[model samples]
Target: KLVDYWSDPDRMKQSYRNAVNKAKNKVTTHQGSKSFAQGRHEFVEMKAIQDESSAKTIPPMKDRGILDEVLKSINRYCTQEQFEDLKRQHALEIEEKRKAFESQQKVLKKFVNLFNRQQGTPSSQF
Candidate 1:
């Protein structure tokens, strides 16, 4: 729907003008890392769409910086609640794996004990 709206020539021109005006009146102060990252991502996406629709190709946007910023934002956004949730999940997964391993070991031990008993050997060695 956004792409379709952007494809309209009259609307595209208006949008381009709006973008230029916005840039001219851009805010100086940072609006936190999350919003800043989101805004940059949206701006790059819009620029790419505009370039695709237009005849004249504009210089490619600096993608590496935006990507790095996004990664940093994600890392920074890991609040205590989210961190605790992740920690809980990790511990749960580890516990489940440990249980599975213990069960396998128990089964192997039982098999070895049964084999020893059949061969008339002591089961205590296993």
Candidate 2:
């Protein structure tokens, strides 16, 4: 599932832009707060406080039996050899996606650093 996400350059770029926008918006939202105006570290602390206050509590799983049944159904549908081949293919895809994502992140980091330098802004702001 994550491999599918990492495989799409357009989607990744969109997500990156959205994250930057969110960060800008966060700064804007906190502009009136004392901590935000105080310092960068204070702003980070304030954000962490807000995040902790807003964090959701996950509900515990109701049943483990369903998982066993799911595994059984999957095994029932595929031969051992077919399952092994699928697993190998999935692993290869995952590895390829991980490498691709790492390279993309490195390139993006360099580009962002260069852009930040040119704009006379800290990369941490975004």
Please give the CA lDDT of all the candidate structures.
Answer: 0.72, 0.67
Q: Model 2 lDDT vs. the true structure?
A: 0.67
TM-score each candidate: 0.41, 0.37
Best by lDDT: 1
Candidate 2 residue lDDT tens string, 1-126? 899977799999998998887787544543454453465655465455445445633333223322332224443576565679899999999999999999999999999999999999999998
lDDT of 2 at 103: 100
Which residue pairs clash in candidate 2?
none
Tell me the number of clashing residue pairs for each predicted model: 0, 0
Positional deviation of residue 69's Cα in model 2 after best superposition, in angstroms? 31
- Please provide, for model 1 over 30-100, each residue's C-alpha lDDT reduced to its tens digit, 9 standing for 90 to 100: 55565655777766876565555464465444455434434445445665655798999999999999999
User: RMSD in angstroms, candidate 2?
Assistant: 32.7
TM-score of candidate 1 versus the correct structure, residues matched by position = 0.41
Off by over 4 Å in 2: 1-77
Off by over 4 Å in 1: 1-77
